[model samples]
Target: MGETIRREWRVEGMDCAACVASVTRAVERLPGVSQVEVNLMAERLTVSLAPGASVAAVEQEVAALGYQAAPLPAPDAAGSAAVPGAAGPDRSEAGGHGHAHGGHADDPAEAGKPWWRTGKAMLVWALGGLVGGAYLLSFILPQGQHWLFLAATLLALIPFGRRAIALARAGSPFSIETLMCTAALGAVVIGAAEEAAIVVLLFAVGELLENVAAGRARAGIRALAGLMPRTALRRRADGTTETVPADRLAVGDLVRIRPGDRVPCDGSIEEGRSALDESPVTGESVPVARGPGEAVLAGAINTEGVLHVRVTRAAADNTVARIIRLVEEATASRAPTHRFVEHFSAWWTPGAMLVSALVILLGPLLLGWDWQTGLYRGLAVLLIACPCALVISVPAAMASGLSAGARRGLLVKGGAALEAIGAARTIAFDKTGTLTEGRPRVTRIIAAEGAAETEVLALAAAAEAGSAHPLARAVAAAAAARGIAIPPASGAGAEAGRAVLATVAGRRVAVGSPRYGAEAARGGLGKLAAAMETLQGEGNTVSVVLADGAAIGLLAFRDEPRPDAAAGIAALAALGVRAVMLTGDNARTGAAVGGALGLEVKAGLLPDDKLREIAALRGAGPVVMVGDGINDAPALAAASVGVAMGGGTDVALEAADAAVLKDRVTGVAELMALSRATLANVRQNVAVAVGLKVAFLATTLAGLTGLWPAILADTGASVLVTLNALRLLGWTPRL
Candidate 1:
């Protein structure tokens, strides 16, 4: 193999999976082209070319298939290179086959334009007028009716004939265009010119409707790209400010965000505090308080105070950009069901054509039918045999599902992960960050007998004030929360993993583990030892406060569960998915958190142990692993679907198959629900697509339907499946 380069192009006029297949087949036939992938929803074509091949060849081949292709800038190019709906020339004006035909092409430039303004809509209208005029003339001049109808049919077949020939040359001989053209021409040959004209008009209208429905499904992703503001208020070094393009904003640039304005880039607050509504990026319903030093994502609304933010990322690398890229790129990762449907469609069209041939040749001999009747019924079967609906069913649902998930901050990598998540029977979660707050918090404070709780807490807080350990911070925070202030402390010193000693109000104070406190307390802990044991048994980290060698109090701390952890677990249970926690923490600590959330605990597991647990769970059924740490990566990859919390480390995000940007445990259940709904939608689409074809094929063979009704059934099935798949764009989890 020679050096290979991967190239991407924005392919316009692709409205369904058959278009994708057509482009793929054309490009794959190019010499030295190793791989070709087309994303129908994103309208993108990606190809891997060896040294001998060129991008020009790939683009030329796609254009020959009735679609327009333009080379995208390299991924590392400056600015937002691949933002969806980026400005480009109209596809129809770019000198290719621009008109819509049966499953052939659509004007992507007309995405947001009104129906009447699109070229496809115009074609439909013109064809409709011609057909209606011919029908009306047939009533007045019966003598010239055949000639008028023939003129209408010939005029309508112009574009379809061109596209059908192009597709046949591109290795797709049985495309919907070919079927429509063949059926209409065969009708005209059999003296069915009137029905042929009407059939051709209906086919054009069907393609126009499919284009409209496809545009609606794509609207969500386009809306995401629209969230990015076009400009930013960049602050100058001399205390002045100037407006600049948001895409030009660089790292470390300070941008001033006014109240009710969206953030232009991902950055940290530097000058002022504010409440930021991050619903646009994270789908978080509530506005969160952000102050100096807190990070803000691009596209979040600054709802309250003005803020001067120091940009931490360039415009193209912001959160919103990554999401848009994720959604567009997701189309490449096809689901198993999608692949199966494509495979079935590949053979379905050819088989239908063969059966249509057999019908045309054998019917006159076996069924005692005349040549005209046999030919008419065979053409009707050929029209019904076009696999447009079956081919489009899976991908349309997948695209709509992914777009909907992105809007809610649930970024499923692709249809594969989306499908696997729905069938998951067990969900394994990491304990530290996934289920709990992952930081120690003060939970209880018990004072020794005869000693005031305030005095004991004050002494402990003063001693811990000089220490920066997590437990010390928890102690100080607990005291501050209760309005207890720490006094002056001096000679602060610590023994690693044992104790911190200091002088508070001229009394020697020590805050340390129970063992260290017992050694310092000359009078012994007395009944405080039992309380310490109980706290430790309950998974709390107990710290003893000793004043002048006498035990004063006991402080119990633990990493508490997140606010919605229980609710998330309960929601999974409601969906028939069992939730379990897998952690490296001790059994006691794991049980403490898991018991609170009512989840099964698998504690003291190493990374390898977690992988083994995942493998074992897979035996019962598909397992989904949700985690946010490096240790969980192995298990994540081993599970059926891996979900990373968006706030997790880069390794976790890269390893997982999906991400919940809101960092809420409840998002897991929401993801599962969305997946189940999407798969259900796919099933509905496939059933409709195949059921209609079967019913129509039967009727055509029974001599009950002819060319016009057959074409109508085929076109209607395509439109129906597309509209059905579009329903997923509005899907929301019931939980």
Candidate 2:
């Protein structure tokens, strides 16, 4: 019984998936540590531990596993989460192991220097010179020329040999470094000293190249952190302006944004008008106009006109900050392919070593090869099956896809959701605020024989004054605009999906669906029934006002469908996805909207009804339920992937798995396409990683490929998959 704390640390020295696993297992074994997640792509580890455990203890455990760990920087008041690659490479600099693995080079001053000047690169060049010189000298010096080759081999093994010995002392005697060292030493034993020198030098060069390519792939994420300005102009109440750090801004503070200045915080415009370039937040090519009451996000450039904006959210909690967090969280989230690769590598490294041993022993016995020939072939087999490429493929692709989606205004929560979206077969959309504009308006008012139109509207508005339902608000807003005075009403109450009741002018007045009026009036609404039917048939949601046992009036409200609803529906259908509209509205209104959008309709659904429907839809395949109301929360959670509209209730947004930040229904199709493409990218990367390893393994086992090609294939596959994954950062659907 202790309190739990969560901490994040940047780890170094992880070259492959096996290193990630090793660090994870070591940290998980510590007392009071409950959860440990290692993000190989981000080079970050998050741990949840009880109060009894200390951060120092966690760091020690990771260091014991042959990696260095350090705490991440504290989050600033502006709420900007540290993005992966924001600082370029592991925080510990791999603890003096040298940034030989792909990351930002260790010395800040030396980073601008050429790669040839780095210690590791210089060593490779030196070994290459020595090996080549000896090979040339052997043609002239016939006596003890092999001694020079041996010297080069021994010199080449120094770096990897040191790492191997260090890992052996740490109890992880079996690692990729150990395997490579064994292969190099085995070459020397088999009288292939020159080949050993070549393999070692080539391996070093390949690693250096891999590091440079991987750094480029990670640069895309780091670029997102630079979008916001460091300082902003604060408008004080005393009519003076002062420039302050963006993080110092608090909610309700007024800020003046001049033309060509980036917005400092997420806020609503209070004065002035301008066109804002929201491409950073929504990826829209054009600038959107902003005026009073319209929200502008931090990081958006104010294109024209000075705007006085009242800060609505702190710097850290702004839309841009949240998007960065979402992207990072998604990148850290693992997919099924990533998990399978990690699991596969757990046994794969050892198994590859065992196979190498078998090759060394059995090749001489079965194929009539000499011991030196058997050892040489076995060493090549070991070098070819390193699994570095296979381990990095899935994570690299996942990070790219998640980052791309965030840039385009789709916030996929994690890698699991990204992968799950590709399999979604059915997408259920909540009718109001999702397919149609959530703004309902009073279009028609029909009064009874004795009731004046204005009188009935005032009474209905009075009865609905306390209700928050969209229909009620429509009636209330219309009454206010028409200058109809609302009389004093008491005991206002709401019945979900039905009516609002209040006592108006000493008579009980009820305003709601026709069924409520009919029941309250005891079947005296015969005259209004026809009018109700006509309005309902026209797709208007008719509200009946009953007072003192008689029907007073009927108000018909219409919520117009979004202009892009049809296009969004068609886009999904073209992708072979079935779109269904679920609404609490009656069948007629639901059908009206669905028919216009060419979608299947399920109407008159209570919240529970929608949940059941979502559950049933899941049986077909993965389902994505899009909604914007509290009633949709259950269904959003029930579906395989829940996509919440940006304008939705907070409950719905929290319940959903993903969110559409632009509040456009068409974004759903865009999101689906992104997910599909991302998963496709993941598959392509996995295939490349796996295919290259298999081909090289076969060639090396047959003695048709040597250590040079084996290491080249391994490094080449890693670079190819990384570059391929980076392509997704620029991917955009034609639609």
Candidate 3:
């Protein structure tokens, strides 16, 4: 049994923010459920539960709250989606549920039909037409036939009247439908039957349009699921091929991809060469070359030659899978602003209701109006106070922004991380692997008296063979390329922040910093001091070799800065964020790379020193640390926010708050632009939602606004905020 499990379901019948609150409450009341998140714009609910919990029980709870919940389809081994259990009826086909005005919603089957052809809409309109025709004829009919107009109003009231009574019994006495029904009944008693029929007709039509707008917003997120391919051609070792699902591919399995085909999985090219369009994965439009030994991401298009790829990750763990998971879980992490809004909205509806009651009871006495006029105006207040737009504003914007960032290869863990990205003032970067290529090449090897250059290189390679450090790998690789045979070393060990020691050919050899070598050699490095200084002055890392307490030789290495490092630094500077470099190398090498990239250099520091630097930077403003090595984990954790490069060590990735999947410093710039855009979008949405409600609420009280205008303003504000939030979904970085 598992400790806990997470499940996602498509939820239907959520017409307003109040419904979101209600469903959340109902599900939380279940026995084993926790961490419920409901996204109204996406119409999805995600829940966490103890192992062995029954999903059906949760779905029943949602059903009892007047909504429908069904498990989402799971991606299968064949690469196609299949329903987790029995697929529930498509909500679109079932029409609107619960108190949906007009007694029906858009039916998927009748979606393209005109208003007159849709069955439920046509019936509602027919009842409305009958009432409308009768009212017009009443102007000319005899007094005896005037009651016929009242009879037509009764027929039109059937659907809403039935639902209003059911909602009252279901304990939602102040629901919008119930309020509309009460207003209509008041109009009939006060001889304003004509106006009452018009009010009901308008409310129904407004709801229909509101539901359609909500559906369109959900389609934006659903489009991402369709980008994955359903099938791939798997190659066997016997020179045979068979069709298989992309998700069934395991590590080391071979898959053949041709021109115009989307790469089936994340893997490395084993044969052939091609130019791939990586826009879907990186959000960059340029094509990249992929030949043998090049790594490729799933969802990239093979635009040019045929390539055989050896899979590197399982289908469920591919880059595309991660992006999808990131988007779905984003809303679970509410921003500070989002949490504030939710807390404020919890009291908004009840407060509005209390205020509406005062308008009904106090208006007639203070303004000297009749009961009908006061009651009619009070109903207008109720309709405008639903808080639907206010409740949805932040989440709709957050979901769009998170999905947009994922598409661009910036994996922000949550809304908090997204917010932090824009607020970062100083970004400290690890010099190696993060700002440079991280591959050092031996430039010069100087042999001491009675020591051969070959002997120095051989000892260094043999000691570094058991290490995984970037510099170690480079030394070993250089020796291998030079056809140098390394002898097996016994009692090999590494000294932290110093050197590696081992016995090679029965001689004790040490390869590390000059200080360590001099101490080990008993201070015999006076002759080679000038030569080491010359190499260090040239921005090369000079490592001294000591053999049996004698200084033997010095090796010099140089690591080149990445091609995009300078440009990325310049972009961050334009955004008003200072770029700082924190490295463990000597000050000379650190200054060289920092000067080249135009950054502030803090060099020759250990991991603890880097942590202190990060803490000091945090005092100026929020700090972001970008690193890709295990040694950088401490600093990455100490910063306000940590960012890890995609190709970095596993420990670094886990320690950081965010990951740049593209392995480029430019991703940092893009993340900043995207987060800033999302924040601005959120502010705009809040202004629109609250601004409209305040303006309309004041207008309704002065008797200038009526039922039709109030409902229109409420529904229209919801549609406007939703459309505004979607702007982030297509936003591109200015750089």
- Give the number of the best model, judged by TM-score: 2
Clashes of each: 0, 4, 0
**Candidates 1 and 2 compared by TM-score, better number:** 2
For TM-score, candidate 2 versus 3, the one ahead is 2
Clashing pairs in 2: 78-315, 78-316, 79-316, 102-211
lDDT of 1 by residue, 1-735 (tens): 667988888776777677777888888888988778888777788888888787788877876776778787753544444445443532322122223453244455564457566777778888999989998998999999999999999999998898888889989888888999999999999999998998899888888777777766666567787778888999999989999988788788999999989998889999899998888777778899999998998889999999999998776677887787788778668899988988898888889999899999999999999989989999999998888888888888888888898888888889999999999999999876678775788888899998988898899899888565557778888888999978989999987546889999999999876667778888889999988778877988678899888898988888878899999999999999999998765566677778889999998676677888999999999999998745467788899999988642344345689998878899999999999999999999999999988999999999988887888667788789878888888887788
lDDT value, candidate 1, whole model: 0.82
Error of 3 at 245 (Å): 3.3
Task: List per-candidate RMSD values in Å.
Answer: 6.5, 3.7, 4.5
Please state the error at residue 338 of candidate 2 in Å. Answer: 2.3
lDDT of 3 by residue, 39-130 (tens): 66556788899987889998876655555676787666645343121123333421433224434433435544543454445655676687
The Cα local distance difference test for each model comes to: 0.82, 0.77, 0.75
Report how far off residue 90 is in candidate 3 (Å).
12
What is the overall TM-score of model 2 with all chains considered together?
Answer: 0.90
Sort by TM-score, best first: 2, 3, 1
